[model samples]
Target: MSNSDFKGQIVVYSIVGCPFCMRAKQTLRDLELPFLDINLDSYGESVRKEVRERSGRSTVPQIFFNSKHVGGYDDLKALLADKVGLDRLIEEVKNNESPPEAPKVPDSSELKKEKIGDMDFTCELDEHAVLIRDLKMSGIIKDHRKGLTTHKNTFQANQFVDWLVKEKSFDDRATGIVSGQDLLDRGYAAAVKATRDGRFEDNDTLYRLLEHDQNSALNAGLTSECEARPASDLGEDLRKLILSLYNDFLTPDGKSVNYKGIAESSQFKMYTRMTAQLYRVDIKSATREEKIAFFINIYNALVIHGYVAVGAPTNLWQRYKFFNYVSYIIGGQLYSLNDIENGVLRANRKPIGSLSKPFSKSDLRLVVALDQPEPLIHFALVCGAKSCPPIKTYSGKDVMNELKLAAEAFLEGSDGCQVNADKKEVKCSQIFKWYREDFGKNDKDVAVFISNHMGPGEKKTSFLQVISQKDYKVSYMKYNWAINSQ
Candidate 1:
């Protein structure tokens, strides 16, 4: 298959700074395919509508090769795996080779253009003021005046103002000319500068500003806002914005934010407040299962976010707050933080003196008796620390995606199983050590569960065979009680 055939055949609809989008581009580059990247950030409502209608997915990093939707990052990876599929795509690209075209401009006839130096100023100033006020009240122009005030000194802002007046025909004097592009560019630049300078202190204020603007944009029907976007389409600036915002509002205490307070705060209500919004989304769910899953996922994500917030090592031990609390909860029903450390997780399971409590045995038995598939299974894993099995980031619609990623990430990072020329020995995760009964009818069940994913290699089979023979020695590793952070 010819690489040049793809020269004019690929159109990648992506947002900037999206990791998945970057991955897709890298894959295409590795395959020697030339393609056009349409930054969806610049896409107008009509263009976005066309994309959504065609793909039925609102997320970015949507790609069309030879007018066929290739799905998202996962799909692209799958296609590249098959040599025939890769070659076919390459052939199509070579046959359609042509010089790449410039970016397409969406049609917007309502945009009025005027020259600051030459055009007559007939549009009434009063009417424009009213329009601006209406936009602001409708939450479309969030702090428009503040944004415009900052633009007065910037060179790009001046150029944008000039463009609005001379090219877009907006009355420079009466409309107080400035382009939407100018606002976005300046907003992103400001967000980036803040991120690089480690401006965690200003995160709240910055997010409030963006939240205001997002409301304005939505009110104007300029964009649709959702929690989950394809990792490929977000631009660097936007991603930084999101990361900054996510880090800002996390409860330092590792406790859930007051639901009442969250509902009342405009800062928490806007979807642009990613962290606060995520909190609200989790707690607001009426379904108990959904709420439980949300809590588990957010708790795991927050543990990571907390480390980044403090500029600390993204390791489990560093996330002690969650681990200690969760471990306490798992050990028993403890009323307070002190009760857990001093009483439950710390207590000797075996009965002491006149106290008839057989602490260690019950703790062990409770853990053993608990079924693997119970909701508590998630909580138990979270408390597993570094040695525990990985907890997948729960996304409601894409359970499989999260599960597969979690499983693969865990296995790849683990040092458990290895196969020699004629023998196999795997140091399985402590999860198997602690919750052996949950795996199957017996210890052998855990071996089978892991082998399914380990593939049918001689090593995996040998390991399974050894477990079946009951000849393999079972040894427990020192389980890290440290929290899983980054």
Candidate 2:
């Protein structure tokens, strides 16, 4: 429509992070049309239902120009393509007259497939109850007493939808909504409210399984202390939890882990409960051993936890963002994966290729940064990838030895180190290549470092012979970025 056709505001209901929504908004901006874009992602089911009812469609980017349905992005584009039609519609709106009804445009293919048949919730209530119990075991159900909503032993509607999508093979949020409504309708679950508003929401409305009493359940071997514990005790308890989780779910070779099993384990529940206590952990008073053991354990645990909560990063850009964004609150301060790795463990240095330091001069987490970077940590920190060192638990009391063992064990592996004596070449894990400065200043220093850490083996004998020659080249093996899943 012409700019003057819209005397009133145009309204577009959209979902946040949807590319189509972004394109629709950009189209309106280019046409110089005034529009209000309401992000449905931020709102509750009440607003979502209003959009669906008003537009007669569940899909987003639902456009309405002064009370006339303009369909979706495709319809808007088509309408704008016909300038005369747009101008006429605008004139009708300006004259306070209804415009002629236009033919409805078919919706974009983003629509999820409708379930083929109706499910009998009454007959399947027991099955759903078991599913709810699984969610509790998986740590999905918890106390969500944040901000104004003082919910207890409950899970958010959005979280339930996510669980259904991931664990139950529900194709989309629409199907999840259907299944959630069935749960409510069948009395398997209920909203934590006296007055219910909608069928099922993909928002922050709290839900509780009617069959289970999470509040009375025993702790899954975790300390019941939700408050702060001494830094030393915290590190030791975390170490045990990490070890237990690894033992239960790690692959035989320790090169991979059963992340899916971990996600559903009671140990994961314990870890989630334990993280709430991290906010009060006194990092400033932590001894060097405590800090090293705590942060390393925290980092490795967080990588697995993040993978369970959110899917693993699938590409380089996602890996970059994942490392930077996924984080935890410790001592009332935020520590991202990068912050814990480069800031706390690496003494506030920047990550490889990153220009800025992990912690700013004024950052509170700087207090937790080590006095000096520990190069041995390069071998201990597991990033949930195959090329990473095998996952292991470390004790603060013997962390120095544990780290040295980790380094030696890594060097003994084919992935970590290989020597080609005849060709006068030595290849090492990309860990050394990525953090070269941490290991040593020169190639020979790095080669010598490798030689020093290499365990007694045929490879070590060959590597040392090459190192003694002092003319061998050092290169990095191609690092594997695959998720180390068992």
Best by TM-score: 2
| TM-score, candidate number 2 | 0.53
Predictions in order: lDDT: 0.39, 0.68
TM-score each candidate: 0.34, 0.53
Provide the RMSD of all predictions against the true structure, rounded to 1 decimal. 20.5, 25.4
- Candidate 2 lDDT (Cα, 0 to 1): 0.68
Error of 2 at 124 (Å): 42
lDDT of 1 by residue, 69-113 (tens): 786667788997789987776666566643334223344542224
Model 1 lDDT-worst window of ten: 327-336
- Output the lDDT of residue 218, model 1: 15
